[model samples]
Target chain A: MPAVVSLSNVHKSFGALQVLKGVSFDVAAGEVVAVIGASGSGKSTALRCINALETIDSGEIVVCGHKVHDPELDRRALRRDVGIVFQSYNLFPHLTVAQNIMLAPTCVKDMGKAEARRLAEEVLAKVGLAEKADNYPEQLSGGQQQRVAIARSLAMQPKLMLFDEVTSALDPQLTGEVLRVMEDLARGGMSMILVTHEMAFARKVASKVIFMHQGKVWETGPGAMLANPQTKELAEFLSNDL
Target chain B: MSLTPVHIEFIATGALWTVGLSAIAFVGGSILGFALALARISPVPFVRRCAGTYIQIVQGTPLLVTLFLFYFGLAVVGFDSLPAIVAAGLGLVIYSSAFLAEIWRGCLESVPKTQWEAAECLALTRWQRMVRVILPQAMRIATAPTVGFLVQIVKNTSLASVVGFVELAQAGKLVNNTIFEPFTVFIVVAAFYFVICYPLSAWSRSLERKLNAGRR
Candidate 1:
């Protein structure tokens, strides 16, 4: 199968500060790719670019065959096939968990309310938040809210999932809860690119590991390749990760 | 001179007119204000600038002047047959719409940007994101301030009296002139205003308190 997402020499800048500098990578169908980097390494920016959340100044980004850098790109169309989860959970606080999930399907897909509610139930169960469907986001703990956020994304049945430092805001116990859900997605053959700080989880669940430094993809190999660092930067990054 | 029964009855009629005028101003202002609020944040630069200029001009000018402009300025431009009440209502609408739009725009922007991103990523259309996700959240932050501003609109309706709309303040002036009891007549009018405004002010405060408590 063709690559699910491919980025060629992507470069982005915010005024005088360059965020992503000549970054290039690809993820095949059903492949789990983990991008590891320190803060400001452009990892999240890269993930955001794939989803058309941020316009790249120079690059060729093809996600499920949509030209991301094209000025006339259909953003909403691209987003339909890619679901992204944020560190802040970003659930609509006004809606119950079920309503939050149902909103996209009902509003975008024109799915009837009954069908949308059922889709919501299936995703909530996948995230292990079946009973919390009636609760508003603010009523949940950090971990539960993150799980609901995941379930909300899953309802879209996206071909590729993007996780932008999703577990960074959670404590250890809550982080474990979210990580398990991610590992479950990986085992079920969901294609995903996650920017994560959880090195062990990244190694175990991500089929490919990409280490980024200073806005460049410094080193990339299979998950086992992390044990044998090819670059001084990779060695330092892994050590600092501890 | 002292107040009489007939004078009190006449003032009561004026108080009723004041309530009616306030309602007209608020309902009319809110309908236009909602549109102006949306325009102030429109994606097109020209539309946003046009809204900005309209708001700035209306907000900078005094409400009394706004009333005069509608009542008299249109005549200067040759459409001279407008009634006092219509001119008065239109002026209040212009004055309140600008201020209300500014208040609402602030509330809409105050919602975390993340919420907007999340909605957009869901593949919801721009209209869907605004109606389903953003406005519900905005309405929460908007309530106290919107109501708080309503008190100002209610009090500002007195400016309509200068155009001879015969609302409470104008009624007081007419009574004072006839009875030569400025203190008693204006005091009663002030009492009418207090009665109208106190409950709304209290409600706005209670809403603000509740919002803060929820945040805590």
Candidate 2:
């Protein structure tokens, strides 16, 4: 099957320091792929490059068959197909959860307000916070806000979703709430690329796991690879630093 | 000499003009200043540079100089029949826009980079992202500052007296000249300004407190 997302020799540099040095990976349709790596291993940079948040110095990042390497590429169209959730859950503080979700659909997609609000309500219900739609981001718990962020992306009906260390910013219980929503998305056949430190979730939910170390893919295999990683880097990565 | 009721009414009339002019400047300048702030952040390099130059020129020159330049320049350009109210109104807008543009630009920049990324990921165009995401949040951070700028605008309306506008300060000067009551007339004029500016200042402070209340 053709991959939903593809990256080849993705090199990114911030001044002289290169973060993603020739990183490559492929995410198939409806697949939940976790990219596990240590801090500064370029996992987030790779995710960002896929959405053109950070320009790649040299490489190709194609999301759902659209190449993002060219500066002239229609970013807005590229974005409509690819959704991203951040660790911080960057919801608009001024707007309520429903307004946040309704913004893009009504404004970008040009959907009617009533239709967008209806879709937002449906998605908010799916995320298990339909009643909290009127609450502002600050009024909701961190976990609730993150779920709303996820729902906001889902409301856009993106072809692929990228999660960059989403739960790393949450408390343990809060992390569980977000992970539960992600699992629901996974089961529903949504394509996802997750950058996470939660080994157990990665092991259970991920169809494939790519172990990145020092800006390169150190190993790759099925979810069982987390049980007995081939490389020393993967072993260390899976081992609890505690 | 005992202050006459006529003197009090005279000051009151002038005070009303102060408020009217301030309302004009705040509303007019805010609309123009918002666009100026957007220009400062525009993707086009030349637009950004032009905005930067505008900000510098307005900020570097004194408001007094700008008022003088505009007042005389209008006459020189054959619009000599322009009322002092119109000339001074134009001057205050230019002055207020520069300060407000800088204020709002800071607020806009304070919105997290991740917010922009997330909006882009949602495929919202630049304008959509700004209207939908960035500005909403930025406006939260902007509210107190924008209202606070209103106080400055109100007080600065007094400066219009220099251009022959019969606002409170200039009206006070006229009354004081006849009565030789600089101490009393100027003091009352100052009180009028205080009354107009103090409420706006309080409103701004309350807004700031509300915005920051979520932190704890």
Candidate 3:
């Protein structure tokens, strides 16, 4: 099957600081690719480029058939096919959980209020947040707010999901809940690319693992590859992660 | 020429004109102010500069000078015989819009950067992101200051009297001139100003309290 997400020779920089240099990866349908690296390794930049959130300096990214690098790329359509969750759980504090989820569909898709509300409820239930739909973001715990952020993305029903250190801010117990939701998504055949630090969770849930070092993909293989690091950098990264 | 109940009634009616002028200035200023705020944050350098220049010029000049410029200055330049009310209302709109634009720009910027990123990732159009996400949040931060500004608007209508508009302060001057009772007449006028301004100040304080309640 063709890859749902493909990045070839992706290069990105913020001014003089090159973050991603000639990086490449592919995520086929229903595949879970966990990207693990130290901060500033460009894993997050690579993920952001796939969603066209950060435009690439050079290279090509095609997500769900949209040519993201093309200047004329239809961003709305591309975004509709890709959902992203961030570490900060950037929920709209002024909106209720259900309203936050409903906003995009109702505004962008012209979905009727009743239909969007139903979708909101369905996604909230999916994230185990059905009871918190009417609550504001500030009223919820950090984990709960993060879950609502996940549900907000899920409500869009994208072809692929990008998670950027989504559980990094949560405690261990809270992280477990988020990981379980991701595991459920993977089992339900949703394609996902997650930048994460949870080694055990990555090992268990990631079908493939890409270890990044210094803006390049240093090592990649099945989940078991993490158990036996070939390069010293990978070994050091894995040890530090533990 | 004596201080009579009739003159008090006339001044009270003039207070109505003061309220009307403030409302016109605020509503008109709010619309223009919102546009100016957007221009201030526009991505294009030229548009941003233009808005900045407009703010600087309006803010630098006194409201009295602005009124004179609109009333007498326009007459000097061949648009003769404009009504004093039109000139006064237009001057206040221009004045209030500049200050309001600056006030609202701060409110808009106070919304965190992550909120913009989050909204953009959702694939919302620029207008959608602003109306749905940014502006709603900014409105909360703006409410107290906006109400406080209204009190300024009320007091500033006194300046409109110079252009021959008979608002409260102008009416006070006419009564004082006729009755020769400057102390009594001016005191009553000041009382009228106080009555109009105090509730707005109280409301602004209450809104500030309500907004901060969630933070604590």
Highest TM-score among the candidates is held by which one? 1
Q: Is candidate 2 or candidate 3 better by lDDT?
A: 3
Predicted chain A of model 2: TM-score relative to the true chain A? 0.98
Which regions of candidate 3 fall more than 4 Å away from where they truly are?
B1-3, B178-183, B202-216
lDDT tens digits, residues A1-242, model 3? 67999999999999999999999989999999999999999999999899888989999998999999999999999989999999999998888889999999998889999999999999999989899888878888888888889899988899999999999999998888888889999999999999999888888989999999999999999889899999999999989877
Task: Please give the interface root mean square deviation for model 1, in Å.
Answer: 3.0
- State the lDDT of candidate 3 residue by residue for B1-216, as single tens digits: 678999999899889999899988999999998899999988899999999999999999999999999999999999995798889899999999999999999999999988998998888998999999998888889988898898899999999988889999999999888889999998989999998889888887777666554343
Docking class of 2: medium
Predicted structure 2: lDDT: 0.87
Residue by residue across A1-242, what tens digits does model 1's lDDT show? 57999999999999999999999999999999999988899999999999999999998999998999999999988999999999999999888899999999999899999999999999999999999988878889999999998999899899999999999999999999999999999999999999999988987899999999999999999888778889998888889878
Task: Order candidates by TM-score, high to low.
Answer: 1, 3, 2
- The list of candidate 2 runs beyond 4 A from truth reads A240-242, B73-82, B202-216
DockQ by candidate, in order: 0.57, 0.58, 0.58
Every prediction: chain A TM-score: 0.98, 0.98, 0.98
Put down candidate 2 lDDT per residue, A118-138, tens digits, no spaces.
999999999999999888889
What's the candidate order when arranged by decreasing lDDT?
A: 3, 1, 2
Per-residue CA lDDT of model 1 for B89-114, tens digit only, reads 99988998998999999999999999
lDDT, candidate 2, B1-216, per-residue tens: 646889889889999999999988888888889999999999899998998899999999998888887888778888765688888888888888889999999999999887887777777778878887788678778988788788878878878988888888888888887789888888888898889888887887777766654343
